[model samples]
Target: MKVTRYTKADAEQWDAFVRASKNGTFLLQRAYMDYHSDRFADHSLIFHDDKGHPVALLPANERDGVLQSHGGLTYGGIICDESMTTPRMLEVFDVLLEHLRTNGLNRLLYKTIPYIYHLNPAEEDRYALFRADARLYRRDVLSVICQDRRLPFQKRRARKVSQAQKLGLVIEASEDLEAFWAILEANLAAVHGVRPVHSVEEMRLLNSRFPDQIRLHVCKENGGIVAGVVVFNATRVAHVQYISSSERGREIGALDLLFATLIERDYADQAYFDFGISNEQEGKVMNVGLIEQKEGFGARAVTHDYYELSVV
Candidate 1:
Protein backbone atom coordinates (compact mmCIF):
# COMPACT_ATOMS: atom_id res chain seq x y z
CA MET A 1 0.00 0.00 0.00
CA LYS A 2 1.05 3.58 -0.62
CA VAL A 3 -0.19 7.04 0.33
CA THR A 4 0.31 10.23 -1.64
CA ARG A 5 -0.38 13.86 -0.76
CA TYR A 6 -2.92 15.52 -3.06
CA THR A 7 -1.86 18.13 -5.59
CA LYS A 8 -3.53 20.25 -8.29
CA ALA A 9 -2.52 17.68 -10.88
CA ASP A 10 -4.62 15.10 -9.04
CA ALA A 11 -7.91 17.02 -9.51
CA GLU A 12 -9.26 14.96 -12.37
CA GLN A 13 -8.32 11.65 -10.77
CA TRP A 14 -9.70 12.76 -7.42
CA ASP A 15 -13.05 13.81 -8.85
CA ALA A 16 -13.41 10.60 -10.81
CA PHE A 17 -12.69 8.57 -7.68
CA VAL A 18 -15.23 10.54 -5.64
CA ARG A 19 -17.95 9.96 -8.22
CA ALA A 20 -17.34 6.23 -8.01
CA SER A 21 -17.04 6.03 -4.24
CA LYS A 22 -19.93 4.48 -2.35
CA ASN A 23 -19.89 7.15 0.38
CA GLY A 24 -18.47 10.16 -1.40
CA THR A 25 -20.38 13.37 -2.13
CA PHE A 26 -19.83 16.43 -4.31
CA LEU A 27 -18.32 18.19 -1.29
CA LEU A 28 -15.28 15.91 -1.64
CA GLN A 29 -14.72 16.86 -5.24
CA ARG A 30 -11.66 19.04 -5.83
CA ALA A 31 -13.70 21.89 -7.25
CA TYR A 32 -15.80 22.17 -4.12
CA MET A 33 -12.92 21.63 -1.68
CA ASP A 34 -10.67 24.13 -3.40
CA TYR A 35 -13.19 26.99 -3.27
CA HIS A 36 -11.96 28.04 0.17
CA SER A 37 -8.31 27.14 -0.49
CA ASP A 38 -7.06 30.46 0.77
CA ARG A 39 -8.41 29.72 4.24
CA PHE A 40 -7.06 26.19 4.73
CA ALA A 41 -3.72 24.53 4.19
CA ASP A 42 -4.99 21.38 2.46
CA HIS A 43 -3.37 18.06 3.35
CA SER A 44 -5.67 15.69 1.50
CA LEU A 45 -4.44 12.18 0.81
CA ILE A 46 -4.97 9.44 -1.74
CA PHE A 47 -4.35 5.77 -1.02
CA HIS A 48 -3.22 3.09 -3.46
CA ASP A 49 -2.81 -0.65 -3.26
CA ASP A 50 0.23 -2.65 -4.22
CA LYS A 51 -1.10 -3.03 -7.78
CA GLY A 52 -1.20 0.80 -7.98
CA HIS A 53 -4.97 1.14 -8.03
CA PRO A 54 -6.47 3.92 -5.95
CA VAL A 55 -8.81 2.67 -3.24
CA ALA A 56 -9.45 5.47 -0.77
CA LEU A 57 -9.25 9.24 -0.48
CA LEU A 58 -9.26 11.55 2.52
CA PRO A 59 -10.15 15.24 2.15
CA ALA A 60 -8.37 17.02 4.98
CA ASN A 61 -6.63 20.18 6.16
CA GLU A 62 -4.05 20.88 8.89
CA ARG A 63 -3.98 23.54 11.61
CA ASP A 64 -1.82 23.85 14.69
CA GLY A 65 -0.59 20.24 14.37
CA VAL A 66 -4.15 18.92 14.23
CA LEU A 67 -5.63 17.53 11.00
CA GLN A 68 -9.36 17.76 10.37
CA SER A 69 -10.88 15.38 7.84
CA HIS A 70 -12.28 18.52 6.22
CA GLY A 71 -13.01 21.69 8.11
CA GLY A 72 -14.87 23.38 5.29
CA LEU A 73 -17.16 20.46 4.54
CA THR A 74 -20.14 19.38 6.67
CA TYR A 75 -18.89 15.79 6.93
CA GLY A 76 -15.91 13.94 5.45
CA GLY A 77 -13.92 10.80 6.13
CA ILE A 78 -12.12 8.12 4.14
CA ILE A 79 -13.99 7.99 0.86
CA CYS A 80 -14.01 4.46 -0.58
CA ASP A 81 -15.86 2.33 -3.10
CA GLU A 82 -17.91 -0.83 -2.52
CA SER A 83 -14.75 -2.87 -2.99
CA MET A 84 -13.29 -1.58 0.29
CA THR A 85 -13.56 -4.28 2.95
CA THR A 86 -13.24 -4.15 6.72
CA PRO A 87 -9.72 -5.52 6.74
CA ARG A 88 -8.65 -3.16 3.96
CA MET A 89 -10.01 -0.14 5.80
CA LEU A 90 -8.19 -1.17 8.93
CA GLU A 91 -4.98 -1.29 6.90
CA VAL A 92 -5.76 2.11 5.43
CA PHE A 93 -6.08 3.62 8.91
CA ASP A 94 -2.80 2.05 9.97
CA VAL A 95 -1.09 3.75 7.05
CA LEU A 96 -3.00 7.00 7.65
CA LEU A 97 -1.89 7.20 11.27
CA GLU A 98 1.70 6.45 10.38
CA HIS A 99 1.68 9.15 7.73
CA LEU A 100 0.25 11.66 10.18
CA ARG A 101 2.78 10.81 12.82
CA THR A 102 5.65 11.08 10.36
CA ASN A 103 4.36 14.45 9.21
CA GLY A 104 4.46 15.82 12.79
CA LEU A 105 0.68 15.90 13.19
CA ASN A 106 -0.41 14.94 16.72
CA ARG A 107 -4.18 14.62 16.35
CA LEU A 108 -6.88 13.92 13.78
CA LEU A 109 -10.50 15.02 13.76
CA TYR A 110 -12.69 12.86 11.54
CA LYS A 111 -16.29 13.62 10.64
CA THR A 112 -18.24 10.61 9.45
CA ILE A 113 -20.64 11.01 6.56
CA PRO A 114 -24.23 10.25 7.47
CA TYR A 115 -25.54 6.88 6.25
CA ILE A 116 -28.12 8.54 4.00
CA TYR A 117 -25.37 9.73 1.66
CA HIS A 118 -23.99 6.29 0.88
CA LEU A 119 -24.74 4.71 -2.49
CA ASN A 120 -24.13 1.32 -0.89
CA PRO A 121 -23.68 -0.19 2.58
CA ALA A 122 -20.35 1.37 3.55
CA GLU A 123 -19.44 1.48 7.22
CA GLU A 124 -16.01 -0.15 7.09
CA ASP A 125 -14.47 3.10 8.22
CA ARG A 126 -16.46 3.00 11.43
CA TYR A 127 -14.95 -0.34 12.36
CA ALA A 128 -11.53 0.97 11.42
CA LEU A 129 -12.02 3.95 13.73
CA PHE A 130 -12.95 1.65 16.56
CA ARG A 131 -9.83 -0.44 15.94
CA ALA A 132 -7.76 2.73 16.12
CA ASP A 133 -9.27 3.68 19.49
CA ALA A 134 -10.77 6.91 18.12
CA ARG A 135 -13.10 8.65 20.56
CA LEU A 136 -16.52 10.01 19.64
CA TYR A 137 -16.21 13.75 20.22
CA ARG A 138 -19.57 14.99 19.05
CA ARG A 139 -22.87 13.87 17.62
CA ASP A 140 -25.40 16.06 15.80
CA VAL A 141 -29.00 15.22 14.96
CA LEU A 142 -30.30 15.72 11.42
CA SER A 143 -33.99 15.56 10.68
CA VAL A 144 -34.67 13.54 7.54
CA ILE A 145 -37.70 12.17 5.77
CA CYS A 146 -37.43 8.81 4.08
CA GLN A 147 -39.35 9.21 0.85
CA ASP A 148 -40.82 5.75 0.48
CA ARG A 149 -41.99 5.55 4.09
CA ARG A 150 -42.70 9.19 4.84
CA LEU A 151 -44.80 10.07 7.87
CA PRO A 152 -47.79 12.34 7.45
CA PHE A 153 -47.21 15.95 8.38
CA GLN A 154 -48.36 16.97 11.87
CA LYS A 155 -51.71 18.78 12.24
CA ARG A 156 -50.09 22.18 12.67
CA ARG A 157 -47.91 21.76 9.59
CA ALA A 158 -50.87 20.47 7.59
CA ARG A 159 -52.83 23.55 8.60
CA LYS A 160 -49.93 25.80 7.63
CA VAL A 161 -49.76 24.26 4.17
CA SER A 162 -53.48 24.79 3.72
CA GLN A 163 -53.15 28.38 4.89
CA ALA A 164 -50.30 28.97 2.43
CA GLN A 165 -52.32 27.54 -0.42
CA LYS A 166 -55.29 29.75 0.46
CA LEU A 167 -52.97 32.77 0.40
CA GLY A 168 -51.99 31.96 -3.21
CA LEU A 169 -48.31 31.31 -2.46
CA VAL A 170 -46.46 29.87 -5.45
CA ILE A 171 -43.55 27.50 -4.97
CA GLU A 172 -41.07 27.30 -7.82
CA ALA A 173 -37.42 27.21 -8.84
CA SER A 174 -35.73 30.57 -8.42
CA GLU A 175 -32.59 32.36 -9.67
CA ASP A 176 -32.82 35.39 -7.43
CA LEU A 177 -30.13 34.54 -4.88
CA GLU A 178 -29.47 38.13 -3.83
CA ALA A 179 -33.07 38.62 -2.75
CA PHE A 180 -33.00 35.36 -0.78
CA TRP A 181 -29.65 36.16 0.82
CA ALA A 182 -31.09 39.31 2.34
CA ILE A 183 -33.78 37.25 4.03
CA LEU A 184 -31.24 34.62 5.11
CA GLU A 185 -28.92 37.26 6.58
CA ALA A 186 -31.70 38.90 8.54
CA ASN A 187 -33.15 35.61 9.69
CA LEU A 188 -29.83 34.23 10.92
CA ALA A 189 -28.89 37.44 12.69
CA ALA A 190 -32.26 37.85 14.38
CA VAL A 191 -32.59 34.18 15.29
CA HIS A 192 -29.11 32.71 15.68
CA GLY A 193 -26.99 35.84 16.00
CA VAL A 194 -24.70 34.64 13.22
CA ARG A 195 -24.29 35.17 9.49
CA PRO A 196 -24.52 32.70 6.61
CA VAL A 197 -21.41 30.60 6.20
CA HIS A 198 -21.02 31.58 2.57
CA SER A 199 -21.17 35.17 1.45
CA VAL A 200 -23.53 36.07 -1.41
CA GLU A 201 -20.66 36.06 -3.89
CA GLU A 202 -19.37 32.69 -2.70
CA MET A 203 -22.75 31.01 -2.95
CA ARG A 204 -23.32 32.47 -6.42
CA LEU A 205 -19.93 31.15 -7.50
CA LEU A 206 -20.70 27.69 -6.13
CA ASN A 207 -24.12 27.71 -7.74
CA SER A 208 -22.49 28.54 -11.06
CA ARG A 209 -20.01 25.70 -10.69
CA PHE A 210 -22.52 23.04 -9.65
CA PRO A 211 -25.73 24.37 -11.12
CA ASP A 212 -27.39 20.99 -11.26
CA GLN A 213 -26.34 19.90 -7.77
CA ILE A 214 -27.10 23.16 -5.96
CA ARG A 215 -30.48 24.81 -6.53
CA LEU A 216 -32.66 27.55 -5.02
CA HIS A 217 -36.41 27.11 -4.57
CA VAL A 218 -38.69 29.89 -3.44
CA CYS A 219 -42.28 30.69 -2.52
CA LYS A 220 -43.64 33.85 -4.02
CA GLU A 221 -46.77 35.91 -3.52
CA ASN A 222 -47.86 38.51 -6.03
CA GLY A 223 -44.55 38.06 -7.89
CA GLY A 224 -42.51 38.87 -4.78
CA ILE A 225 -40.18 36.32 -3.17
CA VAL A 226 -41.25 35.62 0.41
CA ALA A 227 -39.52 32.39 1.44
CA GLY A 228 -36.72 30.24 0.03
CA VAL A 229 -34.50 27.19 0.50
CA VAL A 230 -31.09 26.43 -0.94
CA VAL A 231 -30.99 22.70 -1.66
CA PHE A 232 -27.86 20.64 -2.27
CA ASN A 233 -28.88 17.69 -4.39
CA ALA A 234 -26.93 14.48 -3.82
CA THR A 235 -27.55 11.20 -5.62
CA ARG A 236 -29.82 9.75 -2.90
CA VAL A 237 -30.92 12.87 -1.02
CA ALA A 238 -32.04 16.46 -1.33
CA HIS A 239 -30.51 18.42 1.56
CA VAL A 240 -31.89 21.78 2.64
CA GLN A 241 -28.69 23.74 3.03
CA TYR A 242 -30.38 27.00 3.93
CA ILE A 243 -34.01 27.90 4.69
CA SER A 244 -35.53 31.25 5.66
CA SER A 245 -38.64 33.37 5.29
CA SER A 246 -39.69 36.99 5.40
CA GLU A 247 -42.05 38.20 8.17
CA ARG A 248 -44.99 38.11 5.80
CA GLY A 249 -43.78 34.78 4.47
CA ARG A 250 -43.92 33.24 7.93
CA GLU A 251 -47.42 34.59 8.67
CA ILE A 252 -48.70 32.93 5.50
CA GLY A 253 -46.57 29.75 5.97
CA ALA A 254 -44.46 30.20 2.85
CA LEU A 255 -41.79 27.79 4.09
CA ASP A 256 -44.34 25.09 4.86
CA LEU A 257 -45.69 25.43 1.33
CA LEU A 258 -42.23 25.50 -0.21
CA PHE A 259 -41.06 22.35 1.60
CA ALA A 260 -44.29 20.51 0.77
CA THR A 261 -43.72 21.14 -2.91
CA LEU A 262 -40.08 20.14 -2.72
CA ILE A 263 -40.79 16.86 -0.93
CA GLU A 264 -44.01 15.95 -2.70
CA ARG A 265 -43.46 17.33 -6.21
CA ASP A 266 -39.98 18.40 -7.29
CA TYR A 267 -37.90 15.72 -5.57
CA ALA A 268 -40.58 13.21 -4.75
CA ASP A 269 -38.54 10.45 -6.32
CA GLN A 270 -35.44 11.12 -4.21
CA ALA A 271 -34.74 8.58 -1.47
CA TYR A 272 -34.35 11.10 1.36
CA PHE A 273 -34.98 14.72 2.24
CA ASP A 274 -32.45 16.09 4.74
CA PHE A 275 -33.50 19.10 6.83
CA GLY A 276 -29.89 19.49 8.05
CA ILE A 277 -28.78 19.78 11.71
CA SER A 278 -30.57 21.69 14.47
CA ASN A 279 -27.85 21.25 17.10
CA GLU A 280 -25.62 24.04 18.40
CA GLN A 281 -22.52 24.34 20.61
CA GLU A 282 -20.88 21.29 19.11
CA GLY A 283 -23.92 19.08 19.46
CA LYS A 284 -24.21 19.78 23.20
CA VAL A 285 -27.18 22.07 22.63
CA MET A 286 -30.42 21.26 20.88
CA ASN A 287 -32.67 24.01 19.57
CA VAL A 288 -36.08 22.59 20.44
CA GLY A 289 -38.15 25.00 18.38
CA LEU A 290 -35.97 24.55 15.30
CA ILE A 291 -36.04 20.76 15.50
CA GLU A 292 -39.78 20.74 16.28
CA GLN A 293 -40.44 22.61 13.06
CA LYS A 294 -38.65 19.91 11.09
CA GLU A 295 -40.31 17.09 13.01
CA GLY A 296 -43.69 18.61 12.24
CA PHE A 297 -42.90 18.12 8.57
CA GLY A 298 -42.68 14.33 9.15
CA ALA A 299 -38.90 14.18 9.39
CA ARG A 300 -37.03 11.85 11.78
CA ALA A 301 -33.54 11.83 13.25
CA VAL A 302 -30.19 10.91 11.70
CA THR A 303 -26.98 11.38 13.63
CA HIS A 304 -23.76 12.89 12.27
CA ASP A 305 -20.75 11.90 14.36
CA TYR A 306 -17.26 13.26 14.85
CA TYR A 307 -14.29 11.25 16.16
CA GLU A 308 -10.89 12.18 17.48
CA LEU A 309 -7.78 10.00 17.01
CA SER A 310 -4.48 10.57 18.71
CA VAL A 311 -1.47 10.12 16.41
CA VAL A 312 1.23 9.45 18.96
Candidate 2:
Protein backbone atom coordinates (compact mmCIF):
# COMPACT_ATOMS: atom_id res chain seq x y z
CA MET A 1 0.00 0.00 0.00
CA LYS A 2 1.05 3.58 -0.61
CA VAL A 3 0.18 6.76 1.26
CA THR A 4 -0.78 9.88 -0.65
CA ARG A 5 -2.07 13.37 0.11
CA TYR A 6 -5.40 14.61 -1.20
CA THR A 7 -6.39 17.71 -3.18
CA LYS A 8 -9.60 19.69 -3.42
CA ALA A 9 -10.58 17.53 -6.40
CA ASP A 10 -10.49 14.48 -4.12
CA ALA A 11 -13.47 15.61 -1.98
CA GLU A 12 -16.20 13.53 -3.65
CA GLN A 13 -14.19 10.32 -3.33
CA TRP A 14 -13.23 11.21 0.23
CA ASP A 15 -16.80 11.80 1.39
CA ALA A 16 -17.94 8.69 -0.49
CA PHE A 17 -15.33 6.61 1.32
CA VAL A 18 -16.28 8.05 4.72
CA ARG A 19 -19.98 7.37 4.11
CA ALA A 20 -19.12 3.83 2.98
CA SER A 21 -17.13 3.25 6.17
CA LYS A 22 -18.76 2.49 9.49
CA ASN A 23 -16.68 4.98 11.53
CA GLY A 24 -16.74 7.95 9.19
CA THR A 25 -17.09 11.51 10.56
CA PHE A 26 -18.54 14.45 8.65
CA LEU A 27 -15.33 16.36 9.41
CA LEU A 28 -13.44 14.12 6.98
CA GLN A 29 -15.31 15.56 4.04
CA ARG A 30 -13.68 18.00 1.62
CA ALA A 31 -16.16 20.71 2.37
CA TYR A 32 -15.10 20.84 6.04
CA MET A 33 -11.40 20.62 5.20
CA ASP A 34 -11.50 23.41 2.64
CA TYR A 35 -13.51 25.59 4.98
CA HIS A 36 -10.87 25.25 7.70
CA SER A 37 -7.70 24.42 5.77
CA ASP A 38 -6.41 27.91 6.45
CA ARG A 39 -5.94 26.75 10.03
CA PHE A 40 -3.73 23.87 8.84
CA ALA A 41 -1.13 23.52 6.14
CA ASP A 42 -1.39 19.78 5.46
CA HIS A 43 -5.09 18.96 5.34
CA SER A 44 -5.40 15.52 3.69
CA LEU A 45 -3.81 12.06 3.55
CA ILE A 46 -5.04 8.72 2.19
CA PHE A 47 -3.81 5.14 2.17
CA HIS A 48 -4.20 3.25 -1.11
CA ASP A 49 -3.83 -0.46 -1.84
CA ASP A 50 -1.87 -2.01 -4.69
CA LYS A 51 -4.83 -1.56 -7.05
CA GLY A 52 -4.90 2.14 -6.02
CA HIS A 53 -8.20 1.92 -4.17
CA PRO A 54 -8.13 3.97 -0.99
CA VAL A 55 -8.17 1.87 2.20
CA ALA A 56 -7.72 4.43 4.99
CA LEU A 57 -7.99 8.20 5.27
CA LEU A 58 -6.41 10.68 7.70
CA PRO A 59 -7.79 14.20 7.39
CA ALA A 60 -5.53 16.52 9.37
CA ASN A 61 -4.57 20.16 10.06
CA GLU A 62 -1.19 21.56 11.05
CA ARG A 63 -0.42 24.56 13.27
CA ASP A 64 2.90 25.74 14.71
CA GLY A 65 4.52 22.33 13.99
CA VAL A 66 1.72 20.40 15.66
CA LEU A 67 -0.55 18.13 13.63
CA GLN A 68 -4.16 17.80 14.73
CA SER A 69 -6.92 15.43 13.69
CA HIS A 70 -8.67 18.62 12.71
CA GLY A 71 -9.28 21.94 14.44
CA GLY A 72 -12.27 23.08 12.42
CA LEU A 73 -13.46 19.47 12.40
CA THR A 74 -15.53 18.17 15.28
CA TYR A 75 -13.96 14.70 14.72
CA GLY A 76 -11.66 13.00 12.22
CA GLY A 77 -8.64 10.69 11.53
CA ILE A 78 -7.34 7.36 9.99
CA ILE A 79 -10.83 6.10 9.21
CA CYS A 80 -10.48 2.71 7.56
CA ASP A 81 -12.25 -0.52 6.53
CA GLU A 82 -13.58 -2.90 9.20
CA SER A 83 -11.32 -5.76 8.22
CA MET A 84 -8.14 -3.81 8.86
CA THR A 85 -7.27 -4.22 12.51
CA THR A 86 -4.15 -3.44 14.57
CA PRO A 87 -1.43 -4.35 12.07
CA ARG A 88 -3.07 -2.46 9.24
CA MET A 89 -3.81 0.50 11.44
CA LEU A 90 -0.29 0.55 12.81
CA GLU A 91 1.07 0.57 9.27
CA VAL A 92 -1.09 3.52 8.31
CA PHE A 93 -0.27 5.40 11.50
CA ASP A 94 3.41 4.63 11.01
CA VAL A 95 3.28 6.32 7.63
CA LEU A 96 1.13 9.17 8.79
CA LEU A 97 3.39 9.89 11.74
CA GLU A 98 6.45 9.86 9.52
CA HIS A 99 4.85 12.33 7.14
CA LEU A 100 3.89 14.70 9.93
CA ARG A 101 7.25 14.38 11.67
CA THR A 102 9.11 15.00 8.44
CA ASN A 103 6.91 18.00 7.90
CA GLY A 104 8.10 19.28 11.36
CA LEU A 105 4.91 18.71 13.30
CA ASN A 106 5.43 17.98 17.03
CA ARG A 107 2.16 16.68 18.53
CA LEU A 108 -1.07 15.02 17.37
CA LEU A 109 -4.55 15.14 18.85
CA TYR A 110 -7.78 13.51 17.71
CA LYS A 111 -11.36 13.15 18.83
CA THR A 112 -12.29 9.73 17.49
CA ILE A 113 -15.58 9.04 15.75
CA PRO A 114 -18.47 9.49 18.21
CA TYR A 115 -20.15 6.30 19.46
CA ILE A 116 -17.71 3.98 17.73
CA TYR A 117 -18.55 1.04 19.98
CA HIS A 118 -22.22 1.28 19.05
CA LEU A 119 -21.52 1.37 15.33
CA ASN A 120 -21.09 -1.53 12.86
CA PRO A 121 -17.94 -3.31 11.64
CA ALA A 122 -16.67 -0.35 9.64
CA GLU A 123 -17.06 1.91 12.62
CA GLU A 124 -15.52 -0.59 15.02
CA ASP A 125 -12.35 -0.49 12.95
CA ARG A 126 -11.57 2.85 14.59
CA TYR A 127 -10.80 0.98 17.78
CA ALA A 128 -8.09 -0.87 15.91
CA LEU A 129 -6.43 2.39 14.99
CA PHE A 130 -6.77 3.59 18.54
CA ARG A 131 -5.05 0.45 19.78
CA ALA A 132 -2.17 1.03 17.38
CA ASP A 133 -1.62 4.55 18.66
CA ALA A 134 -0.27 3.78 22.14
CA ARG A 135 -0.41 7.34 23.42
CA LEU A 136 -4.12 7.72 22.88
CA TYR A 137 -6.45 8.08 25.90
CA ARG A 138 -10.20 8.32 26.35
CA ARG A 139 -12.08 11.44 27.44
CA ASP A 140 -15.79 11.82 28.11
CA VAL A 141 -18.21 13.56 25.71
CA LEU A 142 -21.55 13.99 27.53
CA SER A 143 -24.87 13.99 25.69
CA VAL A 144 -28.54 13.96 26.64
CA ILE A 145 -31.91 13.79 24.85
CA CYS A 146 -35.58 13.90 25.89
CA GLN A 147 -35.95 10.11 25.88
CA ASP A 148 -33.61 9.00 28.67
CA ARG A 149 -35.60 7.55 31.57
CA ARG A 150 -32.59 7.87 33.93
CA LEU A 151 -32.31 11.63 33.63
CA PRO A 152 -32.76 13.54 36.88
CA PHE A 153 -35.07 16.49 37.34
CA GLN A 154 -32.64 19.04 38.63
CA LYS A 155 -34.15 22.15 40.28
CA ARG A 156 -32.07 24.54 38.20
CA ARG A 157 -33.33 22.93 35.01
CA ALA A 158 -36.93 23.68 35.89
CA ARG A 159 -36.13 27.22 36.96
CA LYS A 160 -34.18 28.02 33.82
CA VAL A 161 -36.78 26.66 31.45
CA SER A 162 -39.60 28.40 33.29
CA GLN A 163 -37.70 31.66 33.39
CA ALA A 164 -37.11 31.59 29.65
CA GLN A 165 -40.83 31.23 29.02
CA LYS A 166 -41.63 34.05 31.43
CA LEU A 167 -39.37 36.29 29.39
CA GLY A 168 -41.61 35.84 26.37
CA LEU A 169 -38.65 34.91 24.19
CA VAL A 170 -39.41 34.27 20.56
CA ILE A 171 -37.44 31.70 18.60
CA GLU A 172 -36.92 32.19 14.89
CA ALA A 173 -34.89 30.68 12.06
CA SER A 174 -32.35 33.03 10.56
CA GLU A 175 -29.50 33.34 8.00
CA ASP A 176 -27.75 36.15 9.80
CA LEU A 177 -24.40 34.46 10.39
CA GLU A 178 -22.61 37.59 11.59
CA ALA A 179 -25.22 38.39 14.19
CA PHE A 180 -25.30 34.82 15.42
CA TRP A 181 -21.50 34.72 15.78
CA ALA A 182 -21.46 37.98 17.70
CA ILE A 183 -23.99 36.61 20.15
CA LEU A 184 -21.94 33.40 20.47
CA GLU A 185 -18.70 35.27 21.25
CA ALA A 186 -20.34 37.53 23.79
CA ASN A 187 -22.18 34.67 25.40
CA LEU A 188 -19.06 32.54 25.74
CA ALA A 189 -17.04 35.28 27.36
CA ALA A 190 -19.77 36.26 29.78
CA VAL A 191 -20.82 32.75 30.82
CA HIS A 192 -17.74 30.56 30.43
CA GLY A 193 -15.06 33.30 30.46
CA VAL A 194 -13.76 31.94 27.15
CA ARG A 195 -14.08 32.38 23.42
CA PRO A 196 -15.94 30.19 20.96
CA VAL A 197 -14.11 27.55 18.90
CA HIS A 198 -14.76 29.31 15.62
CA SER A 199 -14.24 32.92 14.60
CA VAL A 200 -16.92 34.96 12.89
CA GLU A 201 -15.26 34.50 9.49
CA GLU A 202 -15.04 30.75 9.94
CA MET A 203 -18.61 30.51 11.13
CA ARG A 204 -19.79 32.47 8.14
CA LEU A 205 -17.73 30.25 5.85
CA LEU A 206 -19.24 27.10 7.29
CA ASN A 207 -22.78 28.49 7.13
CA SER A 208 -22.28 29.63 3.56
CA ARG A 209 -20.66 26.36 2.57
CA PHE A 210 -23.37 24.06 3.95
CA PRO A 211 -26.37 26.29 4.29
CA ASP A 212 -28.92 23.51 3.93
CA GLN A 213 -27.18 21.21 6.39
CA ILE A 214 -26.98 23.93 9.04
CA ARG A 215 -29.75 25.88 10.76
CA LEU A 216 -29.25 29.10 12.70
CA HIS A 217 -31.82 30.00 15.35
CA VAL A 218 -32.04 33.10 17.48
CA CYS A 219 -34.11 33.72 20.59
CA LYS A 220 -35.38 37.26 20.67
CA GLU A 221 -37.14 39.53 23.16
CA ASN A 222 -38.02 43.18 22.66
CA GLY A 223 -36.38 43.17 19.18
CA GLY A 224 -32.98 41.89 20.47
CA ILE A 225 -31.34 38.53 19.96
CA VAL A 226 -30.73 37.28 23.47
CA ALA A 227 -29.39 33.84 22.53
CA GLY A 228 -28.59 31.72 19.43
CA VAL A 229 -27.78 28.15 18.41
CA VAL A 230 -26.09 26.56 15.41
CA VAL A 231 -27.54 23.16 14.56
CA PHE A 232 -25.99 20.65 12.17
CA ASN A 233 -28.14 17.96 10.55
CA ALA A 234 -26.40 14.66 9.97
CA THR A 235 -27.89 11.45 8.61
CA ARG A 236 -29.90 10.50 11.73
CA VAL A 237 -29.43 13.30 14.28
CA ALA A 238 -29.38 17.05 14.81
CA HIS A 239 -26.25 18.26 16.61
CA VAL A 240 -26.54 21.46 18.65
CA GLN A 241 -23.06 22.59 17.72
CA TYR A 242 -22.83 26.11 19.14
CA ILE A 243 -25.08 27.95 21.63
CA SER A 244 -24.58 31.19 23.56
CA SER A 245 -26.58 33.99 25.08
CA SER A 246 -26.08 37.36 26.74
CA GLU A 247 -26.59 38.15 30.45
CA ARG A 248 -30.18 39.05 29.70
CA GLY A 249 -30.46 35.77 27.79
CA ARG A 250 -29.94 33.77 30.96
CA GLU A 251 -32.21 35.88 33.13
CA ILE A 252 -34.95 35.72 30.52
CA GLY A 253 -34.71 31.93 29.96
CA ALA A 254 -33.83 32.59 26.36
CA LEU A 255 -31.80 29.39 26.25
CA ASP A 256 -34.55 27.21 27.63
CA LEU A 257 -37.21 28.56 25.31
CA LEU A 258 -34.79 28.49 22.38
CA PHE A 259 -33.98 24.82 22.82
CA ALA A 260 -37.57 23.90 23.58
CA THR A 261 -38.67 25.64 20.41
CA LEU A 262 -35.98 23.89 18.41
CA ILE A 263 -36.98 20.46 19.69
CA GLU A 264 -40.63 21.14 18.96
CA ARG A 265 -40.45 22.82 15.58
CA ASP A 266 -37.29 22.15 13.59
CA TYR A 267 -35.89 18.85 14.86
CA ALA A 268 -39.09 16.96 15.64
CA ASP A 269 -38.32 14.39 12.95
CA GLN A 270 -34.78 13.56 14.07
CA ALA A 271 -34.24 10.84 16.68
CA TYR A 272 -31.80 12.80 18.89
CA PHE A 273 -30.33 16.21 19.70
CA ASP A 274 -26.55 16.21 20.51
CA PHE A 275 -25.70 19.07 22.89
CA GLY A 276 -21.96 18.68 22.22
CA ILE A 277 -19.09 18.01 24.70
CA SER A 278 -18.09 19.37 28.08
CA ASN A 279 -14.90 18.93 30.07
CA GLU A 280 -15.70 16.66 32.97
CA GLN A 281 -12.86 17.80 35.24
CA GLU A 282 -13.68 21.49 35.25
CA GLY A 283 -16.34 20.98 37.91
CA LYS A 284 -18.72 20.85 35.01
CA VAL A 285 -21.81 20.47 37.12
CA MET A 286 -23.46 22.81 34.68
CA ASN A 287 -22.64 20.47 31.80
CA VAL A 288 -24.07 17.48 33.66
CA GLY A 289 -27.02 19.63 34.60
CA LEU A 290 -27.53 20.43 30.95
CA ILE A 291 -27.72 16.73 30.13
CA GLU A 292 -30.50 16.44 32.65
CA GLN A 293 -32.28 19.45 31.20
CA LYS A 294 -32.29 17.95 27.70
CA GLU A 295 -33.41 14.65 29.24
CA GLY A 296 -36.43 16.34 30.74
CA PHE A 297 -37.30 17.31 27.20
CA GLY A 298 -36.90 13.69 26.00
CA ALA A 299 -33.18 13.24 25.35
CA ARG A 300 -30.70 10.60 26.59
CA ALA A 301 -27.02 10.49 27.47
CA VAL A 302 -24.34 9.09 25.15
CA THR A 303 -20.55 9.35 25.54
CA HIS A 304 -17.90 9.68 22.84
CA ASP A 305 -14.15 8.98 23.18
CA TYR A 306 -11.28 11.49 22.89
CA TYR A 307 -7.78 10.35 21.91
CA GLU A 308 -4.29 11.78 21.53
CA LEU A 309 -0.98 10.52 20.07
CA SER A 310 2.66 11.57 19.82
CA VAL A 311 4.44 11.27 16.47
CA VAL A 312 7.31 8.90 17.16
lDDT per residue for candidate 2 within 1-312, as digits (tens), equals 778778877878888988776566455567766775555686568888779999888777667767677666766656776656666776776777777778777677665666522235544435545565645466555565542232434466666777777766678988777877877776678767988777778777777877877778998888788888988876556788888777788777788778877776677676566776655552233465655555665555566655666665
TM-score of each: 0.99, 0.78
Candidate 2 TM-score, true structure as reference: 0.78
Off by over 4 Å in 1: none
| Model 1 score (lDDT) | 0.94
State which candidate has the highest TM-score. 1
Instruction: Kindly give the number of clashing pairs for every candidate.
Output: 0, 11
What lDDT score goes with residue 189 in model 1? 97
Residue pairs in candidate 1 whose N, alpha carbon or C atoms collide under 3 angstroms? none
Cα lDDT tens digits for candidate 1, 215-306 = 99999999999999999998899999999999999889999999999999998999999999999888999999999999999999999999
